[model samples]
Target: MGFFDNLLLNLDASVTGLFGQWNIWTSLLATALVGFLTYQVATRQDPDTHPFLLARQAQGTAVRQPGESPVYRSQAAPHGMLLNAGLNVKDPGASKWSRGRDGDLRDVWRQAVAGVQEPGPTKGAKGRILTVLGAEKIVEHNLDDITRQINLIGQHIADQGGNRVAIYLPNSVELLATLFACAFYNLTAVILPFDQPDDAVISMLRRSATDTVVTAPGSFPFDAVVKNYPSLRQLIWVVDEGSKHMDWNEVPQGTGGSVNVSTWQDIVNDAPLDAGKTLPPLEGQKEPRDVTVFWQSKPGQQEEMVRFTAGNFVSAIAAQIFAIPTSQRMGPSDLFLPADSLANSHTLVLTLAALFSNASVAFNSVASQADDLATATGGIAPTILVATPAALLKLHTESKPALSSFIGSKLHWLQTRSLTQKGMMPAAGGLLSSYYDRTVRPALGTTTTTTTPNKKKLRLIVTAERVGADTPKLSSAVLSDLRALTGARIMYALTAAKVAGAVTQTNFYDYRVFDDKCSHFGPPLTSTEVLFRDTEQYKTSDNISQGEIIVRGPCVAGMEAALGVAGKMREDNTLAYV
Candidate 1:
C-alpha cells in the first residue's frame, strides 16, 4: 500500500478505538467525500464549479423526500435527558465561519476595535465598551495576555488531578481570566457570588468540596472557612502590591490562619506566561460529560455542579434555535444590551444563532429598567434585543413612544424566555396583535436570506416559566392575572410543573398538580440527581395524574455518585429514562 493508504489505515484504527459506534458513520462521511470528489472531477466540464455548488447538488441527491428537507446532521437537539444524537462538530477548525480570507474571532475583535469610530479626540479610549461589567479596562486587556494566563493557571490545576477550584470575587478581569484558566485545564469552577455572608461562603466551600479557594484579597476574611473545612487544602488571595496582605507583610507570629495571600503580580511571575508551555491536555479529551461549574439553588442549599461539554459549547444548541439571519437589516453590527442576570444559555443562543457574528454585549449592574435599556439600545441602534417578560411588560406600559420607535425602526428581532405558560395566555393576544400591527409589520425591512425561507425569518423563542396546574385555561387571560394567580407561564403549567409533583395542592384550568413534593420547586436547570434509582421505581403519571419530572441533560449541575451506600447498583442504572 502507498503512504496515503497506510495513513488512512492507522487513522481508521485510532478513531474506531476512540469512539466505536461513531467511527462507522465517520468512515461513511469520508467515503462520501471521496465519491463526491471523484464525481466532480469527471463531470465538471466548466472551471466555475465550486465545492459549494457540488455539495448542494450532493445534498439534493441525498435527500429525495418530497416536501421533506435535508437536515444538516449537526443540528442541535432539544435540551432533554438523553444524550444528543449525530456527529459532534468540534474536533478542528470548529468555527461556523470557515476562517476564510476575512478573519477568526481574534481578527474580528481587532477589526471591530479599529472599525468603530472613536467618539471624541480621546483616540481609542473614546468608543463604547463591548462588555461594561468585566475587566479593569476591557479595551486595554490584551487577548494574548489573557490567553497566556489561562494556560498558566490550567497547568497548575492539571498537575493536581484537576481538583475543583472555588473562585470568589467581584465581577472583574481576574475572574474572567480565572474562568478561562479553568476551562483550559478542564477543572470544575465554582463561581461563588461575591459579598455573601462568611457563613454562606463557608457552606458553599464545604458543599462544593473545593480543594483550593482563590479569592480577591481581603474580600471576605474567609479564614474561618479555611480553618473549618478539611477539604480545603490551599487558599490564594489576589492582593495589591502595598497591601497588608502582601507577601512581604508578615503575619503576627502567633496568628494561626492557614490561608495564604498572594498578589496577582506574583501569580503572573511564578506561572508560565506562554500558552505553548502552560496549557496541557486536561485529564482527557474533555467532553461535555465533564462537570465544569457548580450552581446553587436557594441561598442556604449546597451548590450543585454543572458540566458543559466541549460538544455543548461547540453545538451551541440554544443559540442556534434563537438566532436571526444577518442581512444589512440585522447582523453583527447590531448591539445587544442584556440584563446581566437575565442572560445565560438564552443569550448564548442569541449569539450562536447569528453565525458567530460579533455584537456588543453591554452589562449593567443595576436593575436595567425599560427606559435605561431602550436608551442604551437606541444609542447603540441594536437590531436585536433580549428582555424578560416582566421587563417587556414594563417597557410596553411605561414608554410607549420609545418602544414604538424601537419596534418601528431598529429592532428586527426580540427573544424572550422564562415566561410561565400561564403568562403567555394573557400576553398572547394583545401583545402579539399590538407588536405585529404597530411595530413588526410596519418596519418591513428587506429580507436577509442565509438558508431556507422560513429559517431566515426573525423569530422569538420564549421558554414558559415552570408553573403548577391550577389556573384558568382561557386564552384571553391577562398576563398580570396569570402571573399573580398562577405564578408562572401558561405552557409550563400545562406541561412540566402542572403535571409533575407540586408543593401545594392546586389545580388550574388545564394542569393537574401534586402538592407537597420537595423536588417540585428546585430549578430544573440547576438541580442534580443524588442517586440513580430504577426507572421503574419512579412514580408514574398514573399515581395522581402527575408524573415525575426527572432532571437530566447537560445543563443540570451537582450530579455525582453517592458514596458509602449499601447496595452496589446494576448495569441498568447507567442510562436515564426521563
Candidate 2:
C-alpha cells in the first residue's frame, strides 16, 4: 500500500510540474493539438467499399475438377444461381406480375426511343446524339432524326433483299443508326474495324459473306470491293455534307448492273418526311438477328468473325449496366463518350448500356487513334469516357514532365495520398487546383487545358486489357497517377475475344496500387464466372492457384471460352495476369 501510494504521488507531482511550466502560448498550443486530433477522428470516413467485401470478392464452388480450381463467380451471382442472361424486357400492356422476356437488340432501340418513363406523371425527354470533329461539334441529331434514318435505310436494304450488311464507317451517327436498323429489320450486322486496309476489308467481307456494305464515300477503292466480294449485291455510300455534291452511286464499269448502289442522303430525301417516327412493328419476329464482330487477335493476323446473338449482346449490356454501384450508375443526365473504337466489344457494350439508360452520346472519328484527348473532347463535356490503354498511357506519359515540377509534384503527392491512403478522391477546383492548372497543365501540350467547369464533371473512365493483344501494360501506379491527374475513378477490365463484354472488371472504388506492372482486374462480371485450368508449370494449390483462365456464362459467345493468357487470383481474390 505504501509503495503504490508513493508511486501515484510521484506521477501526480510530475504531471503537476509539467503543467506548471506551460505558459499561455504552450497551453493554447496543446489545446489546439487536442482539438485538431479530435476533429480528424470525428470526420474520418470509411472506404467506399468495405474491406471485408474486397477480401472475398468472388465465391467458389465446393466441387472442382481434378486438375482445376473450383469455379469462381461474382458474389452477385454465386454457385447454383443463374448468371445474368438478358435484359428483362417488359413490353407495353404486359402483366407486371409476369417475368419479362429476355429482350434482343431491337428492344435496346425501343427503350432508347421510348425515353425514360418515371413512376411520376411527368415523362423524361429523349437523349441526343452528337458528332464531333476535333474539338468542334459538327451536328447534333435528335432521337427522332436517328429513328427516321434507321427506318429509311432499313427499308431500303430490305427492299434490296440485303441479308447481311457490313458497317465499314468510322464512329459516325450513320454506323450507330445502321446497327439499330439491322436489328429492327432482321438483318445480320457485321461490324468491321474502320482502320483496316482495303484488302483486309475485302477479306473480312468475303469471310462474313456480307451481301450489303455501308461505307464512307472515297474512303475505299470501290472497284476492288465490288470486284473482290462476289456476294456483295448492294453498296450504300454514306456521303458527308461537304461531299454531297459528288455522285457516289456510280458502279465500277466491270461489275455491271449485278450490284445495286445507292447514296444514304438520297434514300432519306426520297422518303416521306413523316417516315420512321415509330419503330417498325415486329409481326412474327421473336428475336433479332445475330451481330458479328471481326476480332483481330493481333496485327497482320487474319481476323476471326465472332457472331453474337441478340441474347448474348443484351445479356452483356445488362450486366455492364448493373456493374457500377447504384449511386454511381449512369442515368438520363449523364453524357457518355467512347474515346476508344466501338468495334471493341467492351466499348460497344458500354455504349449500348449508355443508350439504354437514356444518356446522351457523342462520337469522334478519331477514336482509337493517337489524337489529343483534350482536342477530341473539346466541344462538350463527358461524364463517362471509355478509352483504350494506349490513349490513357499517352496522357500519363505526357503529364509526367509537368508533374515533375515542384508545385505539380507536391499537389500530385497530396492527391495520391488522399486516394490511396485516405480512400478519398481529392475535391477538384480550388486555389490548389487553379494553381496546378496554371502551372502544370500548360506544360502538358495539347492533352489537357486549363480546368473548365465541364471538365470537372468526368467521374468515371472505363478501360480494359485484351488478354492476348500486344498492347502496353497499364501498371497500377500509372492508373493511380491517372486517377490523381484526371480526378476520375478508373475501372480496368480483362476482356477476351470470345466474351461479349469482359471476363472481369475492377470495381470503381478499387484504388489500391498493387504493383508497377499490371493492375488487378476485380472480380468476374455478374454475367460470367471464372476458373483456372491447370497447366504443367502452374497448378491449383492451397495457397494460390495459377493457370490458364477459363470463363463460362451467358455473356460468353459460346457459353464457355478458354482465355490463352495465364493469371492468378490474389489474396484479396482479385484477378491479375501472371
- Top candidate (TM-score): 2
Question: Candidate 2: which stretches are off by over 4 Å?
Answer: 1-17, 23-32, 120-123, 255-257, 429-456
* Model 2 agreement with the true structure over 17-114: per-residue lDDT tens digits: 98889899998998999999997898587777876787788888878888898888888887788889988888888787777877887887888888
**Residue-by-residue lDDT tens digits, candidate 1, 338-448:** 432221333333333232333333333332323233432332222344443444344334433543575432321221211222112222334544554444331211223
Global lDDT of each candidate: 0.36, 0.82
Candidate 1: where are CA atoms >4 Å away?
1-87, 90-130, 133-140, 157-162, 170-173, 217-219, 237-257, 269-289, 292-338, 342-397, 400-578
RMSD of each: 23.0, 3.1
Ten contiguous residues minimizing lDDT sum, candidate 1: 498-507
